[model samples]
Target chain A: MRARFNSLPPRLKRGLTVFFVLCFAITLADLVVHKHGDHWWNFFGFHSLYGFVACVILVLVAAWMRKPLMRDEDHYD
Target chain B: MINAPFLILFAGAAISWFFPAALRKPVLLIFPVVGLLNLIALDPSQSWTVSLFDVELTLFALDRLSFIFGVLFHIAAIIGLVFAWHVEDRPQHLASLLYPGSALGVVFAGDFLTMFVFWECLALSSVFFITARGTERASRAAIRYLVIQVVSGVLLLTGALFLFHDSGSVAIRALSLDEPAGLFFLLAFGIKAAFPMLHNWLTDAYPEATASGTVFLSAFTTKVAVYALARSFAGLDMLIYIGAVMACFPIFYAVIENDLRRVLGYSMINQIGFMVCGIGIGSELAINGAVAHAFNDVIFKGLLMMSMGAVLFRTGEMRGSELGGLARSMPRTTGLCIVGAASISAFPLFSGFVSKSMVMSALLIEHHEWVWLAMLFASAGVFHHAGIKIPYFAFFAHDSGKRPREAPAHMLIAMSIAAALCIGIGCYPWLLYDNLPFAVDYRPFDIPHVVEQTQLLFFSAMAFIWLQLNGLYPPELKSTNLDSEWLYRRAWPSLYGRLCRIAGWGQARFYEAVGSLTNALAPPLRKQAFLLLMPWSVREMLMILMILLAAILFLLFLHRPL
Candidate 1:
């Protein structure tokens, strides 16, 4: 199974990439066509931007938290 | 009519002890199915009342809420049993049955007394699974877990006594905050619900449990607390902020924690926070959403835990740092785990999407703008940790050159059933919605909702990929993250050690001062004091009494008549 995945043809790999891009394109298109329930959500790619910003904040905060919160595995012992 | 689901499970636990090894597996599998059937046949309005010592205890009460929880627990029990079927240990099997039985007891309890009894039973029975691991860390973690659970139980009983005193009844119904006992009840439920600062026991202990034991542990305890909070404290305004904090803080810990199971434990808190917020909103839609989410959480969260269990079983490793690239060897487990991760992250067309959106929508309708924003951030954060990090590090990251075989057939079967439920409930929510305590008017699959959710999840994935490409994502390390448990586990012990040293120093100074004073006075006073130390003879006692009498007479004469 690993060999099959590792040896996948370039065309198949490109097809998989296209599939993901198409999915994102559909949601992006919905930003223009669909009437959103909330005005805040109506901005083009609002959720996509919101998701990206939220994740970046999470990573930064976790990095800060590590200074105080991280300890040896047997810190309690 | 004579049987309750709790009784069926408890009896099955007892009978399984006497069964031979070959017969034990079937006995374990059959009990939960029988219990599920018994609950299905139960009448919702019926009550089984037992009067003892002038306190009427409702041992069994089936209502819409209890009915939903009862069915969920039974299903969880069956799935947990299937996952643990390969084990030959009798005690672990007994604990698996009894643990859910106690939770079923909590759900069906109609009064505070009955609830307290089952609540304690839940604590006692569940501890065995942790201790069954037979490692020092597991044993210590179990003890801490037991202490927290027992404290919750004690608080519940104390609150019940006060509630009964004030109200002249122990009925398990919605309570007013004005009641003096209300705070105790809330704290009790808060501890079990893993409410913020009160949540460390879950992360501390769950990762230490045996692999299969963690699967069962994931299902019952915290969800029972969610059920209790919904039953009694729904619409309490304080829960709104409390639940928001609960939802938000854990993602950071999950992000940096090395243990994969502990990460899932943190994610469990994040999921329950949504349900708590839903209950706090208290609208029909919100309550329905909370109950529905609770049901979905058990299946998906249990699925996540089971996958991790399978990983640990194969690799004997729980740390993400030590595990990677197992997808080639355990592809089926990987697929199932991704299903769990997707469901937990609330991806479109998954169980989480169907249920969690109800809470978010209700928050918006109630004009809780800040809370709605926090939950949205949490949704994105959950996608980062539980959704991406779990599968990424465990399965697809840098190969650690360990190629263990796939999980056993039973574990896969259990995971498949749970995975199927996660999708089934996502695609067709009405099967769950129809059983909610309140009517659900909200729709989950509207075009805007689907589009927005997909955009959020996909973009979150993009961020993870971006961080990885930049070499900026934190690597999993072999370490612990300090949480609230630091107070008891580290701070308190260190403080006690310092206190003992100070106390010992004070005592030494006190003795030294007394010893020096005695030594200085000893030469002059020793001879005189030696006479007093001699045993009193009868003649000496008489002479001393006569002298005392004469002194009294002289004093009487000296003050005569004045």
Candidate 2:
């Protein structure tokens, strides 16, 4: 199990395939499934796009913040 | 007989402190169970009251809201004690009992005086958990935590006095924001709830406590604040914005935080934000959502903390940079942590979904469209940081070439119990809904809600994996990221140090000039008449506040004016 865990990158292709497949599947499900929308719920995959974009922006903004905020481990000491 | 449910815990604390070591764990375990049973058997119509010098104090009152919170504290205490089963440390053990005992006290308190005593106890007892670590950082953090907590308590006291003066009663009731000293109540509860600027102590201190100690730290303090806010200031429009900021700001900090436990701490604030927002919404369904979320958060958050605690227990490392591939060694802990992550992330069938969706829906019901959007962004951001970063870096990121044993049986048992509650609550929310303070009309498992929540979570994962593959995600490193506490810890101290140096220089010049004048005229006056001016002390400010409070107390109680 440890050896298998170590070889993480080689399985990226399969992982990506499954990921895209699931993403496409979820988008389709939204069209077929009966659902309620709060705002802009008409667009298929609106939530997917929102979640992805929101996450990306969150990480980028935080990474930018680290420049001034990050300090040495013992900075306070 | 003697305030059965909560005081039993206080008794257990005393027993554990004075009794033999071998009996401690069994005693601790039995107390929460017995407490829960006692709570269940208690008649809600019964009220414990005492007349104290013309003031009526309801020592213990059972209502639907307090009932659920009492149940939660017991469950949290049990899980927390089991997690700390290996801890032979007396202070930590005693504090574990006393801390939750106080939380239950706060929950059941029907008057200000009863609430204040236990409110302060919540702070006083919990500090032992941090001090139990016996490190310089923990010691400093403990004192800072205690000071902030004490200030919050004092604010509560001040608010209660003014409340009693204004209404001629000290009962816990819905206070109008315009009421005299109502702002004090908000500030007091806000500080405990970690409202925006007042939040850093939680993120600062929890990560520094010992492993099991962090679990207890996570459980009680903030949730008690949430309960207090819900009880007192529900429906305040201003809280909507405050809750939104509380929900949104912490995720960014969580994103960059190296300490995994501190990341959880930030997200803890984020979770409480939802509860606060629901309280602001003040609708029946919204209050139910807030209360249920508080219930679920204790279990799921404790589960996450327990997993991290187990890792810290075994490997002695908590930073994401210093941890990796722990799943290979402690597979069960990894699996349980992911359960916690998923629950917090609000996937379709997790505890957070049932409760968080209700708050979001309440936002729309109240026409808080922009706050709703901010909350949605927070959902995504929390998933990015706590949901993904915690498990990925701590368990499955590039193996750091370190392996450690699985957590002890007791710890795993504790984690499993909490994890089970997370899934159980998600799967059978009616088990939670039936006990809520209001009738929960919200349906979390509807096709639209489930589909939408799944889309949000999956795409968040899609972004995380993409960022990781392309090296766009920020790498965890051994560094401290500054937050609000930096004002007191870094900026204020250094600023004060420079000010002290300048003051010292001024004082020296003053003395030298005075010496020269004295030598020329009166030699005897140089040392004795040097200065009547004294440097400022924080104690003096506290003294003034105390004197004011004493005067108010005299006016309120004595009814005699000088």
Candidate 3:
């Protein structure tokens, strides 16, 4: 699954991923708006979503770095 | 009073230097016995005096506060000696003596200067324990530990100098926490006590020490700082917030930590948080709680360290990922470890319950509702990690097929002694509470209080179960979870590395420019300068002769004219 995902073309991969993420986030935001009040809830929700996406990107970069550099437990010892 | 403690320390160091390797461990055990005897015999009221640097010294004054901490320190030393009885290293043996002796000196010293002297001694001596591991990690940790410890001591010295200038008194007694010097002194103590952000050194360094060395390290530095804080900054308002945060931050880290020793390290800071918060409250009840919890924490926390130390010693492994199913083979150690976990988690009828409840209850009665709530959350978090996670992963998690034998007799004895103390104090709270520096009005064992505590603990345990069973909790894995130390350890190192590279590049460019300029100018400048001075001696000689003749004629003319 990971290899297949990695094999996708960069532009198609980028567009589809962003479109899905936006849809999911908007749905989640709408659900929150339905349950809670609008102004403060929308404000916090959008900021949190942005932060989450950033964190995910960072994690992906970290994962990429880790692939080659990772060592077994007794590496130094 | 003075003879045995200092003598035993010197004697231990001397024996370690001269004695056979086989005899050193036994001698290490002997020092603590002699020190404990000296400690138990001292009277707080009848202090023996020595004069130093125009200040009166009470080398063995057992103040109410000092007496309790002194006894605990003595007990911790004895327990640590037993735990490390199998260790053969001469440096470790020497360090074991000096570490506690320095703490004893700090506890008993009558003046700030005396305390500062021992305070620095404690820092200098404890580094050996970390350094003895002889690993790169240990070496790095030791350096960081030494730097922080020395910084604390320097701050203490600075505070002491300022204090002397302001108060014209050298006596180490209670002071208002508002003064600049007082804040410095409090920070010095706070760093050692693992006060929130000031804490990283404890967790960063302890896990890197030799397994046995860690047990000794865990007890003294922070508790001594707690003693200092209780003495100086009790009732300081900021401590409440600092302590609350201290209690909270370690839980997440501990939950995800694979190294059981490092997990215990985080737990150590969490336990200290309770004590600090108690000190902040500063009521008789709160102070009593702080002192009592400090006592209980040393025993149970040391017991936990001893258990983990045993595992590390036997397998040379401490990470939870590499450990599991030891209970099948090492049931005694597992049981003991469970006892420690229970005590730390404040399980009802355990030591943590008796002591920690006092601090929590004090917060409520004082009407600091938010702090009370935070303490409650931290309390549950403590159970989530130190109480359950430690024992679960180390003893009874996924079977790793490792049939490690039980700990050595001496290590077991050490752990049993600490475990027994945990139970003893829990069963009889009056024994601990009555001996606290302040009078105790808070009762720990009312029916309603007991029920409420039980419910809170049971439900938190239930929450832990839910999290674990549902796979919602963070799993312990083989990875380094970053802590505040990352600011200096990782981030600053990378920053410094970048800066050094830039500077190197700049230097290379500058040197290249200078080299080219020097190469271009060298031949012409050298030739021209030499050529300007290349006159023949004959030409100069004739000119000099003519000038001499002219001077003589001119002299004759001037004489005739006159």
Candidate 4:
């Protein structure tokens, strides 16, 4: 599914809005709410950022990995 | 519990082979239901022991752990049997019966000896599922699958024998690494659990299985291994790190992997990683999480495999590169697949959310901070690859223009049953929690838990959407990628063939040079060599025999009667 556009689809727009709103809400709550401990990971938005960035890197690295790993379908022959 | 359910399956399997294809369907469909009823009738706290050579072996038993698996396997069997109602392949029907039977046998086995017998039976019975595809690839893959499975069995037997020698007993119980057999048991269970490098057999073979056969294949083998580990290897610290690695590594391979079923295989390993890590934590809640995830995984992963299998059956295509726009025809299958994807992705109200969150919470309680992070990464990656990529490419992507008919009625019934369970488990996890080996004290729907999990998944999906729009997402293509099997399946074999060719050339040249040198240096020597090396005629053979006889007689005469 290849689609190159400058704008997000309406479904994606709505999803992103929910995601951003959640991130903001969690961030505000984390400042006042006493979690089990105050730590870097306990900070809100870490899960979101890590999840997003890790997945992006996962895709890029995996795509680049194909250069070294990929071979002909009949490579065994 | 074990004998009744497994006996029902085994007897039905044997009898099924004799039935004509038309008659086999009823037998295939009825026996698993009977077995389920029988399973439900049994006492959860029960054991049956027998004497063999002055030793006690438990052939049938049930604890909370094995009892749940017994029920799960029966349900999986029923769903699988119903899915294959239209399949006239009797051997697959037989394998389908015995494979789940063997899994239940393993689950209820209270001693090593009984477990080993059914462990090997699991290997032997499941191979036919792959072979039922009857393609060249399927045949070769079946052999490879059999070899790996038998290797796991051999390891199991080796560990059992060692346990017997060290302890003079073979009871299944929690073990520590100090025991002689502990590491062997870990490696054995590790292999079947699809521990990182030992995992290629799963990805290599499952995709090659027959359409409905893969559904049965997905439900039983690795989950039984998980049960074995939870019984024996729970609280082993190394599994935490091993499980973390298992969780993370498959995401890389799965992203660029073209085969849709193979992607799910990787996803299966990823999901198993969560269970393994939870088992390593070994608290009551953690163990509960591990076992619960195992239960949920069988249902959800089976659902996904059935959906893919249905697509394969309808269109004769499995690779993502070759499938798209299937929703136009198979709307029900598409919707069922989305439910599976959502469940596996751990959407808030899906089966995965209820169980998988338990593992994450357990990780925090046990202070496995790094492993917790790894699992979260795996969770996001799973959403990207399995949850989104699977349905997106299979049903919603660039049209490959293949407009095949919808899945048959039986297959839809199977998918709908699984989808309903996914929803049922998600909504009412207490039905599962009350049956756990330990008391359940965790809440999965807490505000922080649900909110954080949703953030992780939604952001992960956002990343996926961004990648797709930017043309950075790896497009599906038909190609082989190097895995651990590359060493043997390709590299070593190629090296051996080259060495053989070189040695053959060198030997031919050496022979030619020797022949020329002999002719040039001494013609008489060459003639003598020819005469000695020439093929013998019948007269020459007789003459040689006579000479040998005369020499023996002379020697005997010289020695006399001494």
Candidate 5:
């Protein structure tokens, strides 16, 4: 499976990038469309930005938490 | 009345004990189906109630809410039974039946007394799954799990007693927080719901259960708590913030945790938070959303647990640090796991998207802007840990060169059913929504909702990939991340040890002071103390003689005076 994935053409290798581009484009299109509910939905790409920011914060905070929270598997023992 | 679903399951559990090995699996599978059939056949117009010692108990209340939960538990039982078909353990099988039976009992209960009875049964039956692993860690974890569950049960009973005392009725109904009894009930439900600090038992125990045991453990206990909360405490405003904290905090732990199953345990709490928030809103749409989400969670989370169980069964490993690239060997499990992951991540056209959107939309409808934002953040965080982290490290990261066979046929069939349900519900949500307790007018697949959800999930995936490629993502390591359990597991024990040491020191000093006082008084009192310590017989004889002479002299003097 790894070989197959690696053997793919450059265009295919960029599949992840293409997916991200498409997501961003959808977000852009959603900006012009008026949503039925919450005024927050009217903001351009609110959910996309929220997702990215939340994930980044999660990773950074987890890394910080490791200093105090992480211990040997047998720490309790 | 003769064939209450819970009774059938209990009877099945009892009879299965006498069944031979060949008949056990069939018995296990047939019991749930028969019970489900019995449940379906029951007349909703009349409840099965009994009077015990003049106290009324409702055994089967087939209302819409209970009906939905009842069907979900029965279906979960069937899936769990299939997943464990390869096992020959009798106790585990019994527990699988009894656990679901007790959960159904809680669901169908019409009064607090009946709920309490089933609540305790659920705790007792479910603990077996954790202990069935038969490891020292599993035993310890099971004990902790049982303690927490029993505590919750006690809280429920105590609250019920108070409620009965105050109202002279035991009917399970919505409670106002002005009464102290309501507080106790809230706490009891909160503990099982994995409310923040009370949550450690779940993360501590579920991961340690037997491979299939964890699957069953994942489905019933917390969802039953959700049912209790929704039934009795809906619209309690405090649950909104509590649910927000629950949804957000676990992701940090999930990010760094090495145990894949433990991460799932944390994610379970996060998902439950959404349901809880909806219950707090207490609107028709919100309550329906909460119920639907609970239904969806059981299926999808069970699928996730089954996939992890299959991995554990094949490799005897639970840590992400110890597993990678198993897709080469267990491609089917891999594919199914990703499906579970997508459903949980709320990717468009998955079970999660259909249900979770309801809670988010409900929060907005209730004008809970801040709470809605927190849930939105949680959605992304869930995607980070459960969606990206779980599948990424377990199946696709650097190859660890472990070649395990695919999961057994029964396991695959079970997982396929769950995965199909997830997609089926996502694509055609009306099938689930039509059965909700309230009329649900919410449509999940509106263009804006889909676009927003898809953007959020896809962008989260992008972040994961970006971090992974940059070597910035925290590598899964063989370590334990401290959680609320630290207070009881580490801090409380250490504190007790310190207090013991201090008491020992004080006791020693106390003895030493007493001894010193005795020593200081010894010289002055020694001589007199020796006489005092002398045998009393001789001293009494001499004293008697002296007394007799004095008496005689006194008598003589008195006679002369006369």
Candidate 6:
């Protein structure tokens, strides 16, 4: 993931990478408190961990969609 | 006497359709003046009813409530027509006539069915005003508005049917609050009156209309709904809650809205909230308060719309982000807009102060403590957004360096007339009160009431000032905020798209299955039919022919016996 990020355009990629790291850290902290309901590895199994993963997925999906349909601010009026 | 006002209005509308533009405005202006004369000339002490198509159309009831609303309607119509005098379209002028005529019909109708007809008329006529704006957005918004309004009419008709079933009479009068059907009718009125979440149509479409067109749009529909709600649903307990919520919810949104006209639209909803709560309390004072507030709101709100209409007319910009420091050039319009904003904010000695307080007092007397608090907060909210935001953004906010000229003389004259009415009614509350359906026992100028309102509003203004200086208040942003309209605007569209996609896939699969089935059945069906007619089956056919020959011989044997 670090290698993939370092190869991309710096500003936008840096912004997304920071966002992903913050989200991942928040999930890790939440799972530490929640303890994933029962297990020692529960932090990795928590819903927020999945949520962070979903955020990353959505970011990639959104980027893909934006290429085709993204528009100028004055598109409508 | 009752039909006189409507007849005048209808005649004006009919003439406008055929009359040249030179004659239309003057002719339209004359209709409302004649209506004003008819209204003033009506005998307040007597009730007169006329029958049309075997239906009793109460013409001049002169009940205090109808008198207040009717008189206000006449005045508003006159002011609105004059404000839009520069509009050259014949159909629009014709529509303007029909709109008010229908409102008068609703106001004066003696029966539910009569009211329903006028109710539907109001919906049908007002669409033209929006459509006349001639913008794609305006046309779309107008259609949405028409659908909501027409749906309200349908609900009203359905309610009327049930009401007739329940009571076996069509005579319109105050109704008992205990029935579901009556409640349905109230919801219908509530929707048109723009009760809270049902309000976005007013803001959405009114701003999108032609500059001159919106002036007429602001006055009639919701106020007429308030008149209906006050007539039928006064004192229904739930109305208090509904009305309280109506008063409170729109201010924050109005405060942040970029579209100045749309902000006024939100403020319109907020103002109606006061009247609705007053109706719910159902005291003579409270109902009077509602009637008075409706009367005041129509004038001042129309004036506000006119001022903004003036701005839009000259500069062609309606959004707050696109307009500022207009006061330097359009000083007259800026002054008039401030008068409107002051009246709306319930500034002490303003029309809002005189009328809106009666509802608040009714709450206090009824011991509705929390509702009263909600109302007071809403009152402050009104001041913060409409009273301040409107004039501030339009006249004095960050200057955009556009120096549009003053509005035309006719527009200023129309606005002045409305502004004068706002002050006239405030200074002499009895002018409105004496005509209410009930006795006028309430006075607006009690010292304690004045002081308290002054303190409340003045302090609220101070809060606004402090917030502005400290950057604590949310600045007006250029984005559309979601309202109840989100259900139709966003949610329903999404749900509809999803349903269409699912149906498309289902149809594709069904067709595919049918195609495969047809391919599978073709050979077998053909073979079976072919086998039945094959040469191998010729012997069976010959046997059948031999059987027929045997039957014929039996018949010949029977004939010999005969």
**Model 4 chain A poorest ten-residue lDDT run:** A30-39
Off by over 4 Å in 1: A1-20, A36-38, B510-562
Model 1 chain B worst lDDT window (10 residues): B553-562
Candidate 6 lDDT over B256-353, as tens digits, reads 67789998898888888898899999998898888888888998999999999999999988878888999999999999999999899887768888
Interface RMSD of 2: 3.7
At residue B265, candidate 5 shows an lDDT of 97
Write candidate 2's Cα lDDT for A1-77 as tens digits. Answer: 33433456657667767887998798789778765544565577888998999999999999999999999999888
Interface RMSD, every prediction, one decimal place: 4.2, 3.7, 13.3, 2.8, 3.4, 19.2
Worst 10 residues of 4 chain B by lDDT: B553-562
Q: TM-score of each candidate?
A: 0.90, 0.91, 0.79, 0.88, 0.91, 0.80
Q: Which portions of model 2 show Cα errors greater than 4 Å?
A: A1-12, A34-38, B509-562
TM-score for chain B of each model, two decimals: 0.91, 0.91, 0.88, 0.89, 0.91, 0.89
lDDT of each residue in B1-562, candidate 5, tens digit only: 7688899899999999999877988987898999888877778886888888857888878889998999999999999999999888888989999999999999999999999999999999999998889999899988999999999999999999998889877889999789989989999999999999999999999999999999999999999999999999899898888889999998889999999999999999999999988998989988998999999999999999999999999999989999999999999999999999999998888899899999988898889998988898899999899987888788878798999999999999999999999999988999899999998898788887888888888788877866766667889899988898999998888887776666667667866997999999888887677776666797897998999999788645433432
Q: Once model 4 is optimally superposed onto the true structure by TM-score, how far is the C-alpha of residue B8 displaced, in angstroms?
A: 1.5
Please tell me which model should have the higher DockQ, number 1 or number 5: 5
Clashing pairs in 3: B44-B62
Q: lDDT values of the candidates?
A: 0.89, 0.89, 0.79, 0.87, 0.89, 0.77
Q: By DockQ, highest first, what's the ranking?
A: 4, 2, 5, 1, 3, 6
Clashing pairs counted in every model? 0, 0, 1, 0, 0, 6
What is the C-alpha lDDT profile of model 3 across B179-209, one tens digit per residue? 7688889889978888777788998899999
Candidate 2's docking class is medium
Question: For model 4, what is the alpha-carbon lDDT of residue B466?
Answer: 74
Clashing pairs in 5: none
Tens-digit lDDT track of model 4 for B236-302: 8988888899999998999988889999999999999999998888888889999999999999999
Kindly report, for each predicted structure in the order presented, the TM-score of its chain A compared with the true chain A.
Answer: 0.60, 0.75, 0.37, 0.57, 0.69, 0.40
RMSD after Cα superposition, model 2 = 7.4
